[model samples]
Target: MDKDDQPERTVTKPQARVVDPPPDSEATLIRPPPAPKPPASPAPRKDSGNQLPVGTFLGEFEITELIGEGGFGIVYLARDHSLQRRVALKEYMPSALAARTGPLEVSVKAERYAETFDAGLKSFVNEARLLASFDHPSLVKVYRFWEANGTAYMVMPYYEGVTLKQKLKEMGAPPNEAWLLDLLGPLTEALLVIHADQCYHRDIAPDNVMLLKGTGRPLLLDFGAARRVIGDMTQALTVILKPGYAPVEQYAEVPGMKQGPWTDVYALAAVVYYAIVGKTPPPSVGRLMNDNYEPLSQLAQGRYSPKFTAAIDRALIVKPEERTQSIEELRHDLGLDTMAPAPRPAPAPAPARPAPAATAAAAAPSAPAKKGAMVAVAGLVALVLAGGVGYALLGRDAPAPAPGAAAPAPPAPEPASAAVATAPPPAPVAEPAPPPPPPAAIEARFDPLQDFERVAAGQSADFGVEAATAKPQFRIDRDYLSFTVKSTREGHLYVFLHGSDGVLVQVFPNAASRNNKLRAGQTITLPPPQSSWAMKASGPAGTDHFIAIVSAYPRDFGAIGLKVQDGFGMASAEAVAEAARAQGGAAPLFLGKPVCSGDCVDRYGAALFSSQQIP
Candidate 1:
C-alpha cells in the first residue's frame, strides 16, 4: 500500500505562547451564529481522516457540520432529533492513538498506543460524568454521553460566541478591568464549585473561554482532566500544560508541590494578566528557572486599578504556597468579594446517638429487633458450621456428614410465646429435619476476602458494591477496572485492592483524595474520573479482589502501619491481615440486631467484588 493510503498518522504537541484559532462555532449555544451560505455548486467532500462527515447520524444525533477538531476529539454541531434541539456533540477520537477503521468504528493505530488509548477513553467517560454532576452556569453542561462505535460521545448544548482569544483579536486591544471583573465573577464561582468537589481544571486559557454573543456570559470549556491522563500515559508532556498559563507544579508533579485550588487561581490570574498586558506573565517553569516575571501590578500600572492588578499578581505568584490560595481569597483581593457565593458546607455529622441505656431500652420491645437478631445469629452460626461442613465434604466424596460434623447444630429457631406457654407431648418418632435449608447464604458479606468478612461481621442494608463491567473480567493490560460504591448513610469510605500479585493498596481515601467521606446516597466511582490515579489491569494475570469498607467515622490506617505513596496507601499484607483478624468485630446494631448504626462491636459496613484479569 502507498504511504498516503495508510491511515494518516497525526500527533500535534500543545504550542507554547501560541493562541489557538477560534472554532467554526462556539462550544455551546447562545443561538448559534448564522450558518454560512452554501456554495451554488459544492464539491464532493472527502473524509477528514477519522472525522465523521456532515449528515452522519450517531444514535439520535445527526451531524450537521464539523465545528472543530482537536488533538483529542472532534466537535460537531448536530441535531438531536429526539430532543429537537441543536447540540454540540464531542467524539473521543485521540488522533494520534486511533484511526477510523470503518465509517464509525475507531480502532487503535497500533498495539503500542492501545493502553494509552484505553486510558484516555476511560478518562473521557469520567470527564462526562464529572460535567454531568455539576450544574453551575459558568461550567459547561453535558446533556448526556455514551460509549458507542468503539469510542464515546458527549452531547452538549450547541453554543455560539467568540472565544476570549478571538474577542481580544477583534477588539485589537486589551479588555478593560470592569469587563474582566464581570467575566471573573462567574468563572471563579464555577471554579469554587469544582474545587469543593476535589476537581481542578488544570487547563485554563483564552481560547478555552467563550463569551456568549449578546449576554457575554463567560462559559468555561474543554476540561483537561482526560487530556492530562492521555499525556501521562503517552509522555506527550506538551499536551499536559499550556506553557504561559500552566503553573510550575503542573510542569512536574513534584513532592510538596501539589495541584489544587491554588493551581486554578494562578491560571485564572494569568488570564487576567494577559487581558491587561496583552501578554501572559512569563511561563511559570521559565519564571522558576530565572525570576524574570514582572508583576501585573507593575506591568499594568495606570491601565487597571492597583487592587485589581495586585490581586492578579498575588495569584500569579511562582510558589503556590505564597499565592492566593482560593477563588474566595482572589475574589476578596480583587474587591469583588461580595459577588462570590458562599462555599458548599461539608456534610453534617450524624446526630449524636441516644445514651446506650436509653437506646437499648427504647429498642428492646420491638419484635422486629428480636427477629433481626435471631436471623443475624443464625447467619453467623450457619457460616461457621457451613465452613466446617464444606471442609469435611471437600475431603471426601460422600454426601453424608463426617463423624464430627453432626456436632454442629442448626441455629435454634426464634421462640414463639404460644409454643413456650404450652407443654407438647413428645412425638413417637421424629423425622430427621430436612438438611437445614443449605445454611442460608451469608448476608451483606465480603466473601472473597476473609479479612473483610472478619472486619465487618454482620449484614448491613446501607452498603452496596457493584462492578462497572458486565462481568468482573478484564483483559490483562488492556482493560481498566471500575466499580461504584455507595453507602445509604453518611460515612467515611475506604476501598482497598488486593491485586493478583498479592499487593494490597488502599485505592480510595488516599493522600490526594482524602475526602473519602461519602454523603448519604452518594455513589462514588472508584478511580474517580477526577481522581489523580486509575486502576488499570496489569499482569500476573489472576483474580484481583476489592474490599470497600464504610465506617460511621474515619478509621486511622496509621495504626495498622499503612503509608501513603503515589496517592495510595501501600499496605503490608501481613499487617492488613493482622488488623483484620484483631479488629474484625461485629457491625453495630439497633433493635436487637446488627445494624449499620447504634450499639455493637464496630460501626462499619463492607462489601467485596473480584475481577479476573485474563491474558
Candidate 2:
C-alpha cells in the first residue's frame, strides 16, 4: 500500500517546545491557552414566606414578618427592593400606641394626646438621625425612614445571625479571652460612636446586640430607646428598662438618674458578665438594697481574671459617682488602647479692619500747612534779627548812660528769630494697635446624664418621688426592701414574690383581696415579707426568689379582683391559714373564701414539697 494512502497512526504527547521568539522581536509569541475560568458563584436563594412583603413597595423596602415583639414595639424583617437587600424594620405596635394615646374622646383632648405622641415619635426620628449621623463600621447602618398606614418604621441593614442572648444560651459562655475580646471590640466601637453623638443607649442588653453571621462585628440595634443628653421628659414616663441589665439609677424617678455613660458602663459590664458567666450580673440597685449578690468572680467559678473582675466591679458600682468616668476610660481599663480625646483646633484670629484711608489722607493735607507756617516764620525771624542787631549796635554806646535803659540797649530778639531757632517737629507715625484680648475660654460642665461615675460602697444615697401622681415605689436596704405607697385615687399596694419553683410567696398582706391604701407622701418600711415555705417540711435547699413589691391603686384593685392561683394556687381558707402557720406566721386575712376545700392542703403541700426538691 502507498504511504500516503495508508491509515496514519499519530502518538499524542504533552507539548513542551513552542518556538521561542527573539527578545527584541516586536511580534508576540503564541499566547498560552486561556487560564481556566473560575467556577461561577452560586445564585442567592430567594426568601419564600419568610420574606417580609408588607409595608414595602416595589423597588422600596417593605417590612413583612415580625421577627420580635416587645413592650414598646415590634421588629420586622424587610426587603430593600432598590438594593435587593434584606433589612430589619422596627415599628410602633398598635397596642403600645393605644397605651400612649390614652382614652380622650374630645378633639381638643385627642389633639393634645396626639401632640405628645408626635413628640414621642420624634425620639424615634432622633434615634434614626443619630444612627444616620454615624458611619462606623461596627454600627448597623440606617438607610431611610418614613410613615405608612399610620405606622412609623426605620430601615436598617439586615443581619443574619443570632443575638448575644441566643449565643450565650447556645454556647453556654465564651471559652477564651480572644473570643470575648472579639465580641466586645465591636460592641465598644459601637458604643464609642453612640457616646460621640452625645446620646446614651438607655438600653444595652444582650437582646439589643446582634452578631453578623460570617463576620463577628456586633451590630447594635433598637436605637428607639436611645435619648439625647438634654432633658428627655418623655422618657421619664416610659421608663424603658430591663430589670437585670438596668443600673440603680435607671429605676430612679428623677431624670438625672435614668441615664449617663456610667449607666451604659454598668449595662455593658452586665452584658460582658453574662457572656462570661451565662447569667446577668446582679442589678446594682437590687444588690445595694439586698446586699445579697455574689461577686462576678464568685459567679464565674474562678474563670475570670482579676483584671476582668475589677473592670466589671468598677462598671457595676451602685453609685454612678464610683463608676468609670467615661466610656473611653472603661475601654482603657479593659486593656484596649484609649481613644485620644478629640484634638481641639487653635481658634482663628479676629479679622483685621483697615484704618479709614480718607481720614488719614485729610490729616496729611493739614500737616504741610503747619510745616510751611513754621518755615515762613523762620525766614521772617532771620530778617528781623539782622535789623534788631543793627539797631542794638547803634544804641550800644547810648544805653550806658542810664541804668533803667541798660536792659533795652541789649535789643530784644525778634519773635521770628525764636521760631527759626526751634527745629520743626518730626511727623507723627502710627503704631500698630495692641492685639485684641485672647478669645474667652470655652467652659465645660459635668453632664449629670453622661459624666457621673458609679458611686462606690459606703457612699451616701437618697430617693424621692419624681412623678406627680402617687404610685407605688420601692427602696432597698441591707436587711429589708421597703415600699412607699403614694396616695392617689387608689388606696393601697401589695407586695409579693414568685419563688423559683412557681410557689407564690405573699410578703405584704398574707391574705388575698385585702384592701390597703398607703397615704400620699407616706413612707412605709416593712420587713421583707416572710415566706411560709421557708420553715415547712424541708426537701433540698433551694434559693428563695420573691417579687419585691407590686402596687395596685384603689380603682385597679377594685377593678381587678385578686386571683387565688396568684397566691399559692387556690387553697381553702383553713388550709391557707394552717400552711401559713406551718411555713411562718399567719398573714393578715382579707375577703374572698378559699377556692378549694380539704384539697387545698394537698395542693399546697405538694407544691411546696415539689418546689423544695426541684433545684
Candidate 3:
C-alpha cells in the first residue's frame, strides 16, 4: 500500500503566436520552435505505486500479466505493440476507492470520496462511450479507450474463453437445454444492445459470462453499472451484490427501490437458474421473506419449457412490481424476437403490484409492449424504453453497507395466474414468417443494429433471415436468403449486400467469389461457402444489409472511404456512415483498425438485416 510518490511531468510547449509582417513587403519568417515535440508520451512513472509491473508500457500495451482484481477494475494481460496481438487492459482502479500515484495516475481515497469520485469517473466515461457503440458477437470487443495517467483504460479483445463460471466448472452439471438457449441466444441479443443503450448489465453473474474459445460465443462480461460506479465511489467500495442473483430491488436504497430490464431481469433469470439447476435462486431477500424458490415450471418439470420455465419464474419475482421488466419481456418468455418483424405486441401483465395471498397460489405473465418495430439509436430515436432505472446505491455481500439493513418486507398480495405470457410479434409480417416451422430449420440470428436503425428510419428493416433464426417479414422480389460465415480466428471477411438502391453491394468473396480466406472454425456459407447462388435477389424491393467485414487484417474497402453509390449504390445508412467519417480518422470505410477504440472511424461491419415488400 505504499502509493504516493509521483510528481514530475510538465511539457506545455504550444506557444507559437507572434506574427506581425504581412503588409505585402515586410519580411518575418520565424518557424524554429517545432523541434520540441518528442515528449508526446512516457511520463507517468511510479508503476509500482498503483501496480503495472509485468513489463509495464501502457502506450503500445505491454503489461502481460495480472488479469484480475475487482472492486472496480485492474485487469491487464496487455502486449499489443501496434497490433501484433493480445490485449485485455481494463484498469479504472476503484480498489477501495483509488490509489496509483502514477503509471497513469489515480488518487481519491478520501477528500470525502470526491463528489463520489467524480460520479464514478462520469460513470466510467459514460460506460466507455456506451460500450464503444456496441456491435455484438455476444459482446466484449472494445479495442481502445485511454487517458494516460489520471485514470480510465479499457482496450479489450484478448478473449480466449471459458467462464460461464468456468463452463459451470467444467461441466460437473447443468447445460444442454438446447445448449442453454444457444448460449443465451447471443446473450439475448447482447441484452438487446444493453437495453438499447439506456444501459444496465447490473452484474449478471455466472462470473460475468465469457465462453468464446472456439466460437461457443456468449460474451457479456463485468458490468453492474460498473459496480454501481464503484459503489458510488467508496463506501469502502463493497456492494458487489449477488445473493442468488439480486432482485428484491437489489437489496435497497429505499423510497421505492428500482432497477430495470427487471433489474437485469432478475440477474438474467439467475443466470438461467445457475445454468439449469446447479444452484442459486432463493435469495431476493429470501424470496421476499419466505419463498423457497422452487418452480422452474415446478422443479425442472420435464427438463424445461412452460415457456422456458415461465421466463424463469416471471424473472424471479420477489417483486419489482412483480418482475420481468423487459429484455423485450425476457426475450419473449425465452422464445426470443423483438427487433425484427413487428406488429410488436407482447407485454401486459406484471402490475398486480401489492403481493401476498401467497400471490393467490403463485401468479405470473405481466410481460407486454412491442408494436411497430422502430429501433433508432442515439437520436432520431423511437423505442427502447426500459431506461428509467435511475437513483442507485444498491449493494450486498459487503465491504460496508450492512450496518442497518431494513429492506425485506415487500410481498403480501396474492391471487393466481394471468401474466407471464409472450409470443406476439409475428402478426405484422408482410412476408417471411410461415415457411420456417416444419422440417426447414435454419435461424442464425439477426439485428445488425436493428437493421441499421431500420434503414435509417425510412422504414423497411428486416434483412435476410436464418442464423439462430427469427422472421415474420422480408420478401419483395421473391425471397431467397442464406448465411454462414464461421470464423473464430482465421481472418479476412468483407461481404456487403444492401440492395434495391439502398446501395451497399460488395457481395461475397468477390471477382464473383474468390479470396476472402477465413478458416478457423470453417463454415463460410453465403452464396460461395460452396457457391450456386443460393442467396437469391432481384428488383428494387426494400431491405437487404448482409455486410460481414471481419478482420485480423485484410482491409481496403475501396481504400477506406468506400464512396460506392454510382452503381454499387449505398445512398443511406447515414450516407455510408458519413462516407466512413469523411475519411480523416485516418482511413475508415465504416470503422477499422483492430476494431476501433477511440476517434473510432466506424468499425467496418457485422450486419444482418432482411426485410422486403413491394412485391
Candidates' lDDT values, in order?
Answer: 0.55, 0.37, 0.47
lDDT of 3 at 317: 79
Model 2 alpha-carbon miss at residue 96, Å? 3.0
Greater TM-score among 1 and 3 belongs to 1
Error of 2 at 258 (Å): 6.5
lDDT of 3 at 467: 17
| Model 1, CA-based lDDT | 0.55
| TM-score, cand. 1 | 0.50
Return the TM-score for each candidate structure.
0.50, 0.42, 0.25
User: How many clashes in each structure?
Assistant: 4, 25, 49
lDDT tens per residue, model 2, 233-344: 4454235667668888876646546467777888888888777767776656677777565577666656657776777767877777777867887778877655332222
Q: Is candidate 1 or candidate 2 better by TM-score?
A: 1
What residue pairs clash in candidate 1, if any at all? 28-158, 28-159, 29-158, 29-159
* lDDT sort, best first: 1, 3, 2
Against the true structure, what is every candidate's RMSD? 23.0, 43.6, 27.2
Where model 1 places Cα greater than 4 Å from the true spot, the runs are: 1-46, 339-615
